[model samples]
Target: MGVQWSDAADGPIGGDLTAVLAYATPAGGAVLTPIAPIGLRDRDAGRLTFTTSLGFGRKLDRIRSNPAIALAYHDRAHGFGASSAYVLVQGRATIVERPDREYLETVVGPAAARFLGAPRRGPFWDRWLAAYYADRVPVHVDIERVVTWPDLRCAGDPVVDGEPLPAGPPASQAPPKKGAVPRVDVAKGARRLRGMSDLLLGYPGADGRPWVVPVGLRADDPRGYELSAAPGLLHPGARRAGLVGHRYNAQLVGLAMRQHTGWLEVADDGSARYAPHTDAGFAAPANKTLLLLTNGFLARRGLKQAQRARAAEAAT
Candidate 1:
């Protein structure tokens, strides 16, 4: 009833549990923040476990009264109720501006920009965009053997099933013909040029280097995009046509380039990996590739990039 920690080889480690904990949410309320209980260590060959939520929020009562706090994952909450059964992990939590890269690599490892809430992820080509990583700050949450509430059930769908999403659509969506390709049609492909954040531009007079820009200049259809340089950053073939028709085709292309929004891959290590280019995604094994939902425009983006490169070179 109180706390149980260590267990044996087959059975879960328990009985060594130390303390009970109370969680503090970001916004602080009855809601949850999808708190993931991760056991990060200094090595790779160790047993690593974690839990991810669809989306949850937390309350910050302990942070207000007492900074020193730890708690088991909450099962339910109200004005006055039994503290949600959980393993209490009382550790120091603070954002560290100065981080040793080696230490970070050991504990948290690396994650896609999406996890850190960056503008874009993929193979970022712009110097300005790449520099954004310079000011990054890392969070450190010290570890203490908290609770192991395997019996405690969560309110939302916290089941750690085979795949993240549910099985699939109804059987009706299955392939109808024998030789027909079962299309993953969810991908609408090419995003419109409008509001397209021109991360970089290699137009004339910006020197050999591409012009740097924020998420400036929207894509004005496939024809071209505006630049953000003093003179402006415009793509060489910014004069393409039928952007309206090309949109659905280029949607996925834009996504793969956006790096920030590349396709998610369930890695062998059980962590999700993201690739900025289509080649990286395709090069993976079938099991890995099966996780990705590719749109037809991925190829088109590569072709388009090549054409633009040739056009830029000829003009030079």
Candidate 2:
């Protein structure tokens, strides 16, 4: 049976302007990325949806291979409702590669307007954003489990729905052997994340799907950044993981985010250290016009890249 959300859980799930989506990788690791789940498509059935550009073909391909994924609603800043609960939704995702124009206009358009304001409509603006607005793919998640913590900080015991919590981390292939040394400058990475209010770490859970939890910087080590979280949330071992720090103004304007992929080591004593292997991020323009322009540019480029990759795959 599918998970049913209580009113407490529903508020954050349907109201939050954005969510952190974690999808499994073939190697049993997960990629944590931020997504705007515009609104709940089906509240009673626990169906949530998000849209991505075709340019993110690689991520879509990953989902097609491993549908197990999770969504974490850990932020309440500038959202639709008031909630103290932090929600984590574990589910399977199905992709709709090319939604028709009617669906985009009737379904997605109104939902986006509710949070982001009305769409820009003009001869010049329409032409400029044709690809950006039109060439989107929607991914729907069928909820399997919903975990809710009474405190926004996720500090206390969580109430679970749907599937039961696993006894322990599931057995999986060993993480790739990489040098423990940090590849990116530790100080620079830490400095970049300093301004962000929400910092999260994502790793594989006992069910082999990724679990995302809020984390704080405990200290800086020569090897990596040491992080701390609520007790009993993390498994003790060395594994592949991802970290993201992000913040946004009301209505999701003026956004800044930083993401890192790395190796995480958790001590038996619950101490955790992350050694960053790669780093990448971007800050969205605060001006709405400029933001749309940037989105159009990125979307066009991504569409081309997706097409080229598809051609290559066909040839192979």
Q: Rate the local accuracy (lDDT) of all candidates.
A: 0.25, 0.83
Which tens-of-lDDT digit does each residue in 1-316 have in candidate 1?
2112333210211111111123332212111112222332222211222221111101222233323333233222211123333322333344443655665445433332212222333553232233223223343334332333333332222222111222321111121223122122212222322322222211111111111112233222222222222221122221101011101111112221221211222222322211111111122112312212221123234434545765788999
In model 1, what is the error at residue 82, expressed in angstroms?
A: 26
| Candidate 1 TM-score, C-alpha based | 0.25
Q: Judged by TM-score, which candidate is best?
A: 2
Stretches of candidate 2 exceeding 4 Å from the true structure = 170-175
Give the distance in Å from residue 21's predicted Cα in candidate 1 to where it truly belongs.
12
lDDT of 1: 0.25
The positional error of residue 35 in candidate 2, measured at the CA in angstroms, is 1.1
**Best lDDT among the predictions, by candidate number:** 2
lDDT of 2 by residue, 7-63 (tens): 889888889988898887676667888878877558676788888878778888989
Error of 2 at 156 (Å): 1.4
The stretch of ten residues in a row with the least summed lDDT in candidate 2 is 169-178
The clash numbers for all candidates, in the given order, read 41, 0
